[model samples]
Every structure is written in structure tokens, then in C-alpha cells.
Target: MQHQPPARDLPASWPPERTAWLNTGAPMPLLGLGTFRLRDREAVRLSLHAALENGYRLVDTAAVYGNEAAIGSALRELLPRCGLSREDIFLTSKLSPRDHGEAPTEAACLRSLQELGCDYLDLYLIHWPGTQGHPQGDKGNKERRQLSWRALERLHESGKLRAIGVSNYTIQHLRELLASCRVPPAVLQVEFHPQLAQSELLDFCRQKGIHLQAYSSLGTGQLVGRPEVVNVAERQGRTPAQVLLRWALRQGVSVIPKSASPARVAENSQLWNWDLTHADMEELSTLDCGKRYCWDPSSVA
Candidate 1:
């Protein structure tokens, strides 16, 4: 078999300001372990443990990810070893489309709480506009999302969620929700990377007081070995993934890079040591291809 190339490594030290507080006034470590598509329970376990051991306190998961229980197990088992507790970690989960509407949304969040074995979530996001996939496929998508968001608002008011947010939401959706909903979302999780810069939406969120969280911060592996990203990394003496991640961070966005492997998990967390200057930032910003790796919510609703 051909030998695989060495995986990228994280820097030795990072800025202590790598953590940011949520709108709920809860502290969140800027870098988190994304449990999206992390596959095996054991792999998730190892990665979660490694993240916790390596100073990661934020963990992002969703009902759609189908790994809340495994993540819960990892948290329960690893925190003790790392001399931490549930309070020390910032836990986040999402409501799936199948769990839309008032009753189902409430039940789904309760289930997520049960699955994570936590009393309250640091943040709970409405995973997507649709209950499952494309919102355009279902007529009830818009209404269902609105209803589900209302339920999330109740949860936040009742103290079940410290903060409530939406994922994969476009400007139209956000505006619609803002016009109708009582509480504004604290964060908006989106599939943002160098390939799909999301500059406009990010700017909207910033101006509207909604923080942006960059999911697929490394393009879900598409940017791993890309020459454009790699060249920048080589020039900076950093890994391409780090360069990509740092690019998002330089704009004040939180990131979650998923990996079940210990080395990669550890590597993903070390992104705060160096700052990308204004020129480097502008150069990387030009790399945007306006291509999204995930479904674009803008087309749906």
C-alpha cells in the first residue's frame, strides 16, 4: 500500500483569548469538537476525550448527527479523568426537522437533553430550516421552523437552554424569524469555509447582533490538501486546515472542526497562536469560490 502523507500538526501555543462568551453570558471555548459525521462510537469517544484533555470545553452535536448519547458517554467518562465537570464544559445540541412543531420540538429538545444526560444545554440550535433535508421539498418547512423556534424560545425562558440559535439559516429566514419571534438568536451556525466565505451573511449577523459559528471550517476535508490553501499554510509554516480555520477566526467567528482521530482532533484545537495580518487576511478572503459543500438554506426558504 502507498504510504499516506503526514497529517498537519497544531501550533505549540495559542492565545488565551481563544474563548468567547455566548449571548447568554456563558463562556465557550472558541474552538470546539464537531461531532458531525464522526461515525463510530469508539472514535467519537476517543476524539471527545482527546479534545477535553487538550483544553477544549465546547462540544457541538445535533440530533441529526445521531451521536448525542455517545457524546454524553464521552463527557461523563472523560470529564472526571480531566478533572472537569459538566459545568466546566459548554454543551450544545440541535433540534431535527422530524421534531418540528410545538409538541415535537419540545419533545426533541427533551430527548436531546436526555441523550446528553444534562439538565440544560449551553446552547440549542434549530439544526436546519427543513425537518430533514431541503426545505423546498416540504411546504411546512417555513412554518415548522418558526414553530420550532418558538418552542426553543420557551425552553430558553424556562432555563432549559441558556441560549437558542439556528443553523443553516439564510438572511431571509433570519429576517422572517426576527420579525415574528420574541428573542433574537444569539448565534447562527452555517457551513462556512474559505470555499464559501459567507461574507455577506456574516456581516448581516454581526450588524444584527447575532454571532456566527463556522461549521465545516475546513471545508469538510475539501481544503485539506488543496494547493491554494496548502501554499498559504506552507508560507505561514502552518497546516492548510489551520490556515483555513484561522481565516474564519480572524473574522471573529467561532469554529468546530470534526475529527475522530486523536492526532487530528488535537491538531484542530491549536489555532490561536498566530494572527493573520490584514494583507494575509485580504489574500485569503480572495480565495472564496462561492461554492458551498452543504445545502444552501437560501434556496429553500
Candidate 2:
């Protein structure tokens, strides 16, 4: 069954308490800045600075994103100016599929730490269930996943990773990991939007106390053009992007939306202090058609 927290009255402020407690008892900001496919260092620096100025406390990056150093530079330059410290921000990065074995995974984490100039990560995730060089049908795929997960467990024990989790894992993959994992996953990052609800997965994670986080929450700019989303935005006096983000938050999930534009970054962070009506929620929910703006992991096996 899906878990539903009772709705409270709307607040009369700009930044509401938009945090969810992880299994580790640490508070994670629900809305964050995602750095994916952002290769330009100068652009990344400017965008990240703007995001921090706009009240984004959480920043998500991955080794595959190839922008960790850029983000690190931005943070180093902007944190003190913004009157914040490292502890005040939540930083997350993922292990690449190419580094799936135990030793490689551990090495990769250390490398990421060095590149980001951080002593530890707020959260680390397995980028995917499958290995990079190994074929999908390779018998060692599952073993590799298990080994990498074990490495993550050890890192968690060492306090290098405050929380550990996986991304792009389906129900079957999650079940397998749960069966053998010594430490339960604290979060599951996946491609989520109004058009790809993944209701079953969301319910299963909720029951297991795994915080579900949505990536590509705006459908990579497709949902903004949808009539349903636009209509809801018009009625609620919010932007189409805000309406989509609010829809995700209403499902008790966290969302990380990416934008290099300063204006868009500030606009996306304005999700607090308001909400959508029940009728609007239902209308948006009915638009789910399994559309994915990112890679599909259902066939990872």
C-alpha cells in the first residue's frame, strides 16, 4: 500500500520545510539541482552559483556526468560568499557502471571525493544495476552488482557516505538486492514524472522505508508543453514546471530538476508555499503512459 501523509494547511512563506528524513535520520532537501550532461565548466560554475543563490541546498551529480570538479569549484567559490558551510548543503554523486566491481567501486568513490575536494559524500548511489563492459546476459552481472553494493556498505560504515542507495533499479532488482544486502538502501533515484508514475515501485519503496527520489521530474521539457499540465498551471497560478514538481511532491517523493538557466533554476525552487487541488492531482495522475525521458532500465535483468 502507498503511504500518504495527511495534508496540512499551506504556508505563508517562500521556503517551507521541504525536507525528508532518510533512514539514517538525516534530513534531505526534497528539491535539488541535478547536474547531468552539463559539460561546460564555466556554464556549470555560473549555474551552480545561481542555484545556491536561489536557495538550493541539495546538489546532485554523477561520475558519468563528468562535472563533479566543476561543481566542486563552484561550491568552493560560492559557499563562503553565501554564508554556508559544507554541512549545510547536501551533496550526492553516483558510481559509474564502468566501475562496478568491489575494488573499482571503492577506488571510484575515493576518486570522486578527491575530485570534489570533499571528505565524504552526503549520499552515493549505484548508477545502474548492469555493468558497463559486461553484456546484459552475462552471468557475472548480478555478482558484480552485489560486490559493488558490498563496497558501498563498507563506505557507509566508514562514514564516507552518510547514506547509500541505487538508481534505475526496478522491482526485481531491488528485491534481489534487499535479499542479500546487509544495509538497506536509504534512497532510490529513478526517472519519474506525471507521464511515468511507476506507482507499484513507489508503493514498494514507501513500505520498505526507502525514500523515493524522482529525476527528470519535468519530463525533459516535454511535460511543460502538455495541455493537462498547462491547464493546471493556469488554474493554480503556477508555472507548468512547478505544477509537475508539486505533483511529484504530493506523491511523497523527492524531485531533482536540472536547468542551466539562472531564471529557470530560481523558478523551479519556488515549489514551496503552495499546492494543487485534488481534482488537479487526479487529472495529472491520469496522464501517466509510461513515458521515459531518460534511459530505460527495465530490461537490465
Q: Point to the candidate with the largest lDDT.
A: 2
lDDT of 1: 0.81
Lowest lDDT 10-residue stretch of candidate 2? 6-15
- Runs of candidate 2 with Cα error greater than 4 angstroms are 1-16
After superposition, candidate 1 runs with Cα above 4 Å error: 1-16, 133-139
Q: Record all residue pairs in model 2 with backbone atoms less than 3 Å apart, i.e. clashing.
A: none
**lDDT of each candidate versus the true structure:** 0.81, 0.88
Best by TM-score: 2
* RMSD (CA, Å), each prediction: 7.8, 3.9
Tens-digit lDDT track of model 2 for 1-301? 1223423322222144677777776677788899998879888887788888887888999999999998898899898998888877889999999999999999999999998999999899999999998777677888999999999999999999989999999999999999999998989999999999999999999888899999999888889999999999999999999999999998889988888888999899898888899999998988999988898988786
